[model samples]
Target: MAIYSSAVFPPSQLWDYAVKLYNNPEVSAACLRLQDRRGLDVNMLLFSVWVAASGRGRLTDAEMIAGIEAGARWQADVVAPLRHVRRYLKGDIAPADNRLAAELGRGISDSELFAEHMELQFLNEILTRPATGSFGAAERGEAAADNLAAYLGHVTRDISRDDLSDLLQIWQQAFPGADPRLTGLFGPSLQ
Candidate 1:
C-alpha cells in the first residue's frame, strides 16, 4: 500500500476519507454485504464515495470500468483467496483445530485488509483530479450513486433495484446529514 504524506500526491485526500469511512462499522458491514451478496467490489464502492466526498463529479462509466479493471487481477488472485481462506476458517468447513483456525483467520484477515489498501492505492493513483468547485451533499450522493450503478452494471448482467436500495440505505445511515435529495433518489423504500 502506498503511504501518503505531505510530500506525496499533495492534493490526494481521498485515502484518508476512505479510511475513516471504512472504519465505520455500518459502512464496513454494508460493504461486506455488497461484496458477499451482490459480487460488488468494495474497493470501488469506497472509491466512489471518496471521489464524491472529495468534490469530484460522478465518475464516468469508462472511468469506473477502468478502476475496476485496474485492480481486478490483484483482487481475484490475492484478496479474494485470502478472504475465502478467512471465511472458510470461520466456518465448520475448516478441518483445523479451533485455536489454529482462529489464529490463521486473524492473519488472513490482516492480509486481506492490506490487499484492500493496495487496491485503494491503485485507485487513488488513477483517479482524475477533483473538480475545482464546491459540491453539495446532494451532488456528492448523486455522483456516488452513479458510480456505484456503473460498477453494478459492469459486474452483473441484471442489476437489482433492491440491491441498489440496500446500498443507498446504508449510505444514508452512514451519512444521515446528506442532502434530502440524496435520500429521495434512493426513494421511500429505504427505512
Candidate 2:
C-alpha cells in the first residue's frame, strides 16, 4: 500500500496550502476538531480556503457541489478506511509488537496522506480561475469567510461559538496579514 510515486498525485497549490496551514498547531487542531466533531470533510474545508485564499473567488453552487460530491466519494472509499485502520494500529488492541504496529501505522499514515493529496487534485480540477486581476487581502478574506461558512452550512447547522472560534483560527491562519476585522465576517449564517 506504500507507493512513493509522485506521479500518482502530482503536486498542487492546494496541497501546498493545506500543508502550510495544517502545520500551524492551532489550525491543525481546529481542522481536526471540525473533522471529528462536525463530521466535516477536512479536504473540502481546505479546498474552500484555498479557493478563496488563492484569489479564485467564492465557490459557485455548482463548484461547491462538485467538490462536496467528489470529496465524499473519495473519503468514504479510501481516506476514512485508511484513517480507521491507522487509528486501530495505534490502539492498545493491536499486537504486542508495538514497534511493528508503529511502523505499519506510519505506512498507513503515508497512504492516508497520499489519498488526501489525490482528493486535493480532484478538488483542484473543479476550480475555475478568475481573470488576471488583483484580489486584495480584504477581498480574499471576505471570500474565505464566505467559503468556510458555505461549506459549514452544508455540513451542519449546529455550529457553536467554539466552532466559530476554530473557523476563525483557520481563516486567520490562511491569511494572517488580512484585516483583523475579517474574523467577524466568518459565520453570519451561524449568527
Report per-prediction Cα RMSD to one decimal.
Answer: 4.3, 2.5
Candidate 1 residue-wise lDDT, 38-147, digit = tens: 77788888887777766886787777878989878878898889888888899875356888878777878777876777788788878657565688777777677666
lDDT of 2 by residue, 12-84 (tens): 8788888899899999999999899888898888889888788787899889988998899999999999999
* Candidate 2 lDDT for residue 33: 95
lDDT of the structure predicted as candidate 2: 0.83
Top candidate by TM-score = 2
Please report, as a residue range, the 10-residue window in candidate 1 with the lowest summed lDDT. 1-10
